[model samples]
Target: MPLRPVAALAAACTLALLGPSAAAAVALTPLPQSVRESEGSLALPGRFAIAWTGCREPMLERAAERFQRDLGRLTGVETFAAAGPRLEIACAAADPGALSLEAREAYRLQVTGEGVKLDADGPIGVLRGLATLRQLIETGPDGAAALPAVAIDDRPRFAWRGVTIDTARHFMSIETLRRQIDAMEQVKLNVLHLHLSDNEAFRVESRRYPRLHEVAGHGQFYTQAQIRDLIAYAADRGVRVVPEFDVPGHARAMTLAYPELASNPAGAPAAGAQVLNPASEAAYRFVTRLFDEMAGLFPDAYFHIGGDEVGDDAWAGDPQVEALMKTEGLTTKAQVEAHFHRRIHQALTRRGKIVVGWEEIIDTGTLPRDIVVQAWRTSNATARATALGHRTIVSAGYYLDLLNTAQFHYGFDPLDTSAAGMSPADADAARKLHPLVGRFVTDGVVVQPMAPLTPEQEALVLGGEAPIWAELVTDEMLDNRLWPRAAALAERFWSPREVRDTGDMYARLAVQQDRLRRLGLQDQAARARMASRLAPGASEPLLVLLDLVGPVRNMAHDKRVPAAIAGKKIVQNLTAMADAAPVDSLAARAFLARAERAASGEAAARAAVRADFEVWNANHRRVVAIAQDHPAVREALPISADIAEMAAVGLLALDALETGKPLAPETAARAKVVLDRADAFEAASARPIFSFFGKRPPADLIIMVTPGVRRLVEAAGG
Candidate 1:
């Protein structure tokens, strides 16, 4: 008989014998490519044990320790190392040490009646298998620790799945950074890109130039010792730490430390200084020395130069830059920028480093071909960079700071057709346009595009990153701002392209949120703490309000304060409704979507809608009571009242629909008026409040419940 026949017969026999056990298996996030369930389960003894062999690397030892700790926490049992029928972790080879194309980070995990067996080619793969095994642990009917019998073979689809944290905008503590790395490892995210310098601050200590951290860092920079420890910590968890020191532009902090290197030595601009003096040989020397020091600090091979947002006015008023431009026969500012990048690239290249920069650098075409271009702003930039023989990482759709829904990021893929909907002529024309020319032109300058990636260019795409720009994000809000959403993006990067089930992802994410919380990620707790601060004696009302609303999307909050006058006047506080909430209310959105479908006949969905309305209708009184005493809550009362009225109208419509009674015309009219009033309130509420000092918008409420309310009325009328 053929092997296929024998395999098929064995699979059928196994399934028939272990029907319930196979069916009761938990769904894994970043779903493994292949999984098989057999007849049986693994029960954890009073003392959980892990037996390891084959790899003597320090990272493997750390991984084993982590597994024991996490297993104990999750199962509430004492975990220890032992031999015999228990968890077995084996590596076929030594630790790869670094994450790269050749690193074997794939593993096979099998949990059976005998025990749990995890096998991998390297220690990194063993670490990944441990994450999956932890996720597989569940409580049995007898309330004992148990795991479903299953065999899973899994690997990431992309090699460079990463997250970029901007510590320069707002400093993050090393403890917080390490905690984030722990969560990233649990999600199998392998890279931590630290943006260490920006206009606001230089976030790393430099012994070579003390002032870079002493004066410019405002006492918030990380020491070299802390960074080395962090790198070691991340490595043990199989995460690569890539440090970014932005240059030329976003150089206010650097220039603050040494004014001689600035394009305009008059001091930083209101928009926080634009670029360094390309004409100054001293500036080049400073950058080179700084990068050399950074290279020593960050052992990772790739370094981000942050070559984005260079403005023409940056060098317009600089005499030295102008003189050099004239002497060098440089016709435009773009050429000057190109020269700046070329020199910086040469410096890094001499240090055996591969330079990485934003997509703006791609337009120069003068940098080394080995450079990695991060495409942000434009959709087609990824393809454009790849077509030019440069590797690309996409961040345009993965901008976590934009407050976009996780579904929005999930729908974006690196391999999407770059020119799918464009006309054939336009598509060809787009290809001919300068890669620097973005989709939208402002003041005759090409910015960034809004296009996608073509299939042919997909091979050059390494992966993508979710960047958390910290302009609006404080350290307290970091957890809520990143997690759960970042987890979805992680799946997009790790899982196969066909695993695009948003519903399933959400279901899995719910479990992930709890796991992350248990592992000490503080998103929920942080939000609750903020709510308690805002409400003092009573936080339930505030919590209830936050659960139904989220922050405004698309940088609307930032735009409210005009940039020209913003000038360090923009204050980030918990007073704004968005401050405590995330961009997307997944639970509310999913509930609304379900309610719309269930309005036709589903009893449970209808009840859910009714219960939501009742809660909101009662929440208004609670909000009003709390608002009188809390200024923060008072600022949101108008929006709260509108929500209450909207809910009241929805309850009336729901009643009419359930009773099969035609809604009174006046009642329907009142409902429409309430909806209109709510919309107007939201529009007016978004306007910035101009005061004696400056202009700033009060935190606007994200009206998540209104859409469901509208659906209820529409269903009643129909």
Candidate 2:
């Protein structure tokens, strides 16, 4: 089906459609492709029942139970099989158990004064329709729940709307994984790409090769029974779990467990030995057996063999690799990788798997055309692969662990082909908006212009994923890191290419986060717990500070921070200001809105912006008092001072703008110095050198409102 303007269906919608008795109108994420709302509401049945008209299928029946429970929870009314009002679900043609890229997920939901009728071609479609139905619910003036009168026709824009859950770095509980899976289904996300094994650890228990988990897991890994349950859970929610077991490199933990598989002759589980000896027959036997066994556990056809970061340190002068290179006519590092990947690819494909690897898989030679390459580092990853008839998943700009805000990631369209989502002018505007912060989220990208592909090659792009690498994240804060932002990216994958309204996306995103929380995700609760832990008797002030500040962006919060600064390897300290701050600063966003309006010469907006600065200017003293008293969180003191000083600077700049005068050069210089220091701190954090890394890094957080301050001072034209 040719795609329509994704949000255009609701482009003409108005609050009038709610018949003047609705609580805010319906705002759905991954907005349906088609919508027509009218002036009426369907009061939810006080007594509800689900009328499943589909074939006798367990998936549909289970979905009905879930919906009925949601109904009672939402409406405060009990529902039973014998009911007064019915939610009629009709899917006569659905293959209830089928879930894949080819599965039919299109559904039409019509909610009128009479009742709700959900029609779909299959069970997956019914689930999707049910999700939309849940979103359409609103509170009536009578204080009762109601469904706004509307009709929606919806289907995901991409077959692979995915999220990557990294359990290898920090083992997430099965409960945590299931919570994300539930949230995924609620937003129409269809794939859960599990980063199961990495250099840090192997997260999945291995019964066949006991040592892989026993020795390497360090007492934490999911058992096979748990994996099976997870797979079944994800399947019921229409999510496919694709497991990634990195090979050739990112193999420190793997080699540590099986010394015989190490690339280094001495079997040292160090940096240089962080790769399996691909030339060794033992390596091949281990890989073939382990992968084939894993293939049986994960029923999905796609399996990710992490073929990324195959560093020269691991292969440069290794004797086994060199001898194999000479004998196999592999002249370079890339060629040697090709030999290993080709063998691994053949091994998995023979066991009925479509081998998925990182963008570096291209180094593995021509190999089989059926291999799926995950485009992580660059757009060229997709461009080069699609040209060779290999399928690709674009993940270049969706690294959620970068601490980028939602709109920044949403801008990177997998199919835009030109500029990824922003033009030169847009990018310039974005960077200037937060010049003081130095590394505005958009600064680090070097956009690659994709060579135009034929229609056939374009189809090879199977959507994208938002990867939440667990380096700086763990089960405690994973929800806060991935959510709401992932919801925005989910729309990019599920909604149309034309749905580019960042403002609208943010508005709906707020609603989606609240909905997900109510549905049992703990992002906000976790953040609150960490904040309370930081300032025992004074969490309110710390919470406010967190809402205003953001965690350091990109790889700024990596292992080197502790290794060089704190003299440790990677520490999961949850009470620090860095851990408490969320990547998206709600206060910063609100302040920026008013600042934007004030910059555009609005009067009331100027007052509101000034008020925000005033609050921040005073709020810091409380936070400082709380932080200094707690040694574990004393790192927040400098950041607390900066927030107050910056807020004062903002007030000064606003006064100059209001009085129609230039800021004094001295004041502007001071503001610039502070902003420059903040930017420098972010830059230094991401580098790997001692001078930059160990230089008593200025606070662990980034000021999210630096852009407004910079804009005002620059606007004062000092």
Candidate 3:
């Protein structure tokens, strides 16, 4: 409602271009004073009550049950008491009255004598109507429900809605995954692209290549039984699980299992902690064996083979790889990549698995016609892959892992049909390019980007997912990093783009977050706290949430502080309080105290504050130094200064709240001024820290400076 004029215009244009059938057709009306009690559900005078028909089909039934449950939970209405206007549900008869052709794709909700009858062509249409009904529900301060009357007929432009999860970086427990699958189904997402293997972790339990799990998994691989169970679980929820195994690159985990498959002359590590050895004969054999097992485990016909981020460095470094390149008469890494991938394609063919890799694989020009290229590098790559003869999945526009905003993801076109530079020109051109490209026969390219999908673009995208990369991820930090954010991703994958109106979705997500909490997801708790502030009645929750301060610590000034003292102040404060106590009340009390103190005007507060902070920092270092060696504290420290700074800020904010005043403005401003500089420092420092112990952090006496700053700020009452 507060949208800027240009933003509003842009949104309107986007909806109009997408077409009326694609957007939720609804009218917003003020709640009539006479019907204040009926603010949510069909209690309001202008509200629409919707009934369901033909929803008993197993899939529809399952979906309907979930939808009904979500509505009840979200609107906080108990249907059993029948206090609110009830929407009746029935399976349509052989000859139910029909709507006009224009309304065929969406539902027509009419108020009947007894209740509302929601007539739709099918279950999915009914589902859309349900979503519309959900949007209509509103609660007043006194718990009144209200809604506006409107006619909505909506359908998505794309049929296959999907999201991907990277199981390769850090293996997700089957339970955690099932919960994710359930979450997806609730949001109407139909597919799950499972990135099963990556450079850091090999998740498949390979019978033919036992060593893959034995060596690469570091005792964390999923058993074959688990994969089978997961497939069944996903199917039951109407979600297809498409497995991806990155190859010719991002293969360090595989090499760990079968060292022989790795390039005999090892090169520096690449993304995913993997560096594939292209010249190893053993690598080919090992890859084939792994694929054989993968094919058997994943029933879905399409398999992902990551071929992105295989830097040219590896190809140029190995002698045997060079020799092979010369023998094949290939001059570039692209050609060698093509040659190598073709071998994997042959292996996949034998196992009845269609290969899918990154855009780089297409850049090599050797993939088979059936292969799907997940283009992550650039839009040019999507068009190039399509032009070259490979089917493409547009991830370039969506890489949610890049910390990009959702609007950016929404604006991109998966198929470059509009661009003059790469659009298909004619029949002869099509024929020549069709043989090598996957898009020639079928509209093979589907855009499935990572998170941050606006409702409109999310609906427009074939689907979207949230990838969990391991650079800053660990077992302890996974849930905190992914949840709630992943829920937003699921919404994009499941809900139609037209249904997007972040305001409403954000509200619905709050209820979903509560549900996630009931389901025992700790990560969603952090997300709920962070996201709560974006909504009304959220200040209390946001204040209480114990934010992670490591990143804040890293963001502090260039002043090098020791790691031992990094989170010392926050940890000390937390230790002083009850463990796992609600951060909100604590934060509230502290903030009020600081406010009172600042208003009193204590100049002595300045010197006393600085000296107190210095002393606290020194004490924290001693405590943290001992704590770091305590084994427990030493194990969980983050590797990056950025994370450290973030952690420091979090701790300092908590302390500042406790003192009843804001952080010292001078220190805060100084930190802000140098934040960008800190980012660069972390980027340069991360490599050495990450590479120290085979991509793990190093143990040192001083600790990192990021965490130290966190200690200083927290001690300084901010």
Candidate 4:
């Protein structure tokens, strides 16, 4: 927020004014707090430029430079210093302080031909304005660049809008992480929670405990200098980087590096080897020193000490741990973990930091009120944590690796008491699955009811985060694993609670993805890259297949990770169909929308629906050929043939509709049998075709288009 203006750019590249684009309603993501548009548009030319006034904060300059680059890249305008129509940025009232908890993010903008003004309370607010402004750029008539004539007043709904990236398992390069930060900044999201350590590896370099980096990291970790550079990079963009150092539990990597730090250094770490030596005084001292060093690197006030998943009998074989537990009245692992948390809390708090823990830390009720608990188990966890006066963040319904649709996560609000808008089937499944992450579940955890929080408790509830654990993701696959979906979820975090229209969110999401792609995110490109890897010159056919399939939902069900794929070479699991597929099939959703119209007797819609079936009926052969060549993708081969059969069924149903007659008894029975064979009982569920796999199989992709075909068949009276 402090003044640090950059040297203005004067690039000679042409802005390529492609004239005015088709006039359409604005489709802003996280939709603005208030939007009022009049009846005109502002035309921009190759000479279009930006000028600053009121304040020249370095953050503001950086925002301007980004705007200049993105505007040109997105619109082919090549923005630079010029004379004609320009964007005037005013920060006279901007809070001139370091970007942090107290920073003001409110902004108001007026766009018109006379002058376009971006006014904000701080540099961060200006960044939000510029982001919104970038989304507004469109090709007007004559293929010229233009912006809508509108007034927008916007501010974030939550103080913390973030995503937690797990880098310890699969190390993402600094570029990958930096790209994430850039995407976050564009969406007005303010936090980047880095899960830097886990059982698989420690991700941050440690000068104090060198082996934690050398041996524990397995030759892959962020250097101290890289961490500092990342921190500075995020700071400049008004994004804070919060570090997570799992303690007690998820400390296997650290123990492997420093044996003396394990709970049973005297014996081989067997029971509770995944955790620290809770009974050892040396463990406490080590935590204190390590946290102090970590605190110096991550300047944010909050720190995440993983206090989840410690087994109750983790100390079973160790007599020292047993004697200590008996002496300390620690009846359960939660209590033992709390004992560890208390020391970690004191250690981090001493270094001028507030401690954050997974929801499990709240179970023992021993930690102070200041701890922040990420309630991922259930929304009820938020209520429970806040009931105990502990600040909490909601993350239960926003697990990115769950492979849920953006609309699904978009509909899940942090303050909800009931599963209002959820399909009865999915809501029921969630209740059964809630708080139970299979092996990831901590012992005796409650499947909390969706209870509403009180006003006081709601005040204690912070924002939520979308966690993308890297076990099933690699550097190339991470973007598609996140983006476009994260953009919609970001809306949930930053926009008003009333902005719950899944339909509108998706429409705007398409535009937001294009902007994100222009800003260099690989979410839309990763699929193509993966497809080409699977099929050299014919990736297009695979892409057609990818559009209609998705990963099997639920981490417990994802077989492409270490749980099923064994060995550190889990990264090789990328060749699975899910690796190339999206979290959900947008193409399938669109097909269904058209099928709904076709069901209503729309001729054009029916024809379009038939064309889609034609594509599916034949696309499988190419996929089958590629899958035959790649054993990792062989699972897709059978699934591909099944789609062809379903497509043939759809064509049969369309023939019935065209003839204005129901299928003959024998024909109807045959069609029903085919559907019954491939259908996942409930046609709307993910993986509607692959229900035949053993509970968990590496070939884990769902045929999303099957449901649409089912709808068509039903409409044809089959």
Clash count, one per candidate: 6, 2, 59, 15
Best by lDDT: 2
- Write model 2 residue lDDT over 1-718, tens digit each, in one string: 2333446544423222212312455778888887777777887655455676756488878887787677665544443233545677888685734678888888999888888899997888988998888787775556567787888888888889998988888889989999999999989999999998888898888888998889889899989999999999998888889999999888888888887787774434443357888789989999999999999999998989998877655666668878998898888887878888988988998998999988777755777888888887656667778888889898987888878789778888886554343344545654554432224324223355767667887899998988998877889988888888888888899877788877667656766777788788898788889877877877888777778778766655665544544455665555567876778875576566567767777888788878888888788877767766766557776877887888888888888988889888889888998888777765544422222233344456877787777777787774
Tens digits of per-residue lDDT for model 3 on 1-718? 1212322322443333223221222211101001111111345432234344554556556655565555555456554234445565553432221111122223455432345556666544565455445544555566555544433333444444566677776567787777767655444455678776767777877888787788778888788888889887776555678888887677777767666566644554332345566666777877787778778878877777777767656666678888998888989888878888888888888888778776667657655767876655445555555655665565554544433223334444454322212223332343453342223222222322323433443322332334545443334344544444455555444333344554333333444444555445665343344333332343232222222211211112111222222433221211110112221121222232232233343443333333433443344344344444344333223222333344345445545645767787875765553343444433432321111112112221112233334434545544
- TM-scores for the candidates: 0.87, 0.86, 0.57, 0.88
RMSD of each: 6.2, 5.7, 13.5, 6.8
User: Lowest summed lDDT over 10 consecutive residues: which window, candidate 3?
Assistant: 28-37
Indicate whether candidate 2 or candidate 3 has the larger lDDT.
2
lDDT of 1 by residue, 49-99 (tens): 667778757778777777777866775655323322477888888854456
Candidate 1 local Cα displacement, residue 541, angstroms: 1.0
Worst 10 residues of 2 by lDDT: 13-22
lDDT of candidate 3 vs native?
0.49
| Greater-TM-score candidate between 2 and 3 | 2
Model 3 ranges with Cα > 4 A deviation: 1-56, 68-72, 75-150, 159-161, 266-282, 313-328, 350-352, 404-466, 475-480, 483-718
Q: What is the lDDT for 223 in model 2? A: 90
Preferred candidate (TM-score higher): 1 or 3: 1
Writing each residue's lDDT as its tens digit, candidate 4 over 494-563 gives 8878776665566567667777888899866778887777767767777887888777665534443433
- TM-score of model 4 vs. true structure: 0.88
Selected candidate, larger lDDT, 1 vs 2: 2
Query: What TM-score would you give candidate 3 relative to the actual structure?
Result: 0.57
